[model samples]
Target: MKKMPVALMLAATVFAGVATYTVPAQAATNSVVKPELDEGMVKLEVYFSSYPPNNYSDENTGFNGWLVGVTPLPNGQYKGTYYGYMY
Candidate 1:
């Protein structure tokens, strides 16, 4: 599997600015139950705790899915994530 780019990870995780991420007062929480990987692919596991419990799976199932893809830049100085562009 390809390793994640340091810069891209930094930009996304480190220097990334934050905005209010609103969630419904209900719904089931997420535990990243499973991931189906393709050949040469990998994943970064993340955890979520819902305020109302089981939010993602229960009520927010549609708008609340998961991030899946990451690709390193040509020069290897940066990386991009499919999740970054997605909600």
Candidate 2:
């Protein structure tokens, strides 16, 4: 009989997750989307910036890459496979 309660709880959790997950898909797709930066390098997206930023300002050029996947190697230098615009 105790198993019945545990089973119901598990079932409820699964249903809750599915219901919450599927509901978001119905929202209207907007313009924000991550392009194919590289082969599995999409995880390197740092930030979102506007084009023609300040007419020609180098500071606000655009969303430069991020240090997302960068890692510290044994050489004490951080390195990672990055794919994006950088100056």
Taking the tens digit of each residue's C-alpha lDDT, what string does model 1 give over 1-87?
Answer: 999899888777644444223443232232333456545443332333312222122233223333442233355332212121112
Write one digit per residue (lDDT tens) for candidate 2, span 1-87.
Answer: 445688899999999988878854214222234356664333332222221111121256443443223334455543332345534
Total clashes in model 1, counting residue pairs 3 or more apart in sequence or in different chains: 7
Query: Candidate 2: how large is its RMSD?
Result: 12.7
Candidate 1: C-alpha RMSD to true structure equals 18.7
Clashing pairs in 2: none
Q: Which ten residues in a row have the lowest lDDT in candidate 1?
A: 78-87
Model 2 TM: 0.28
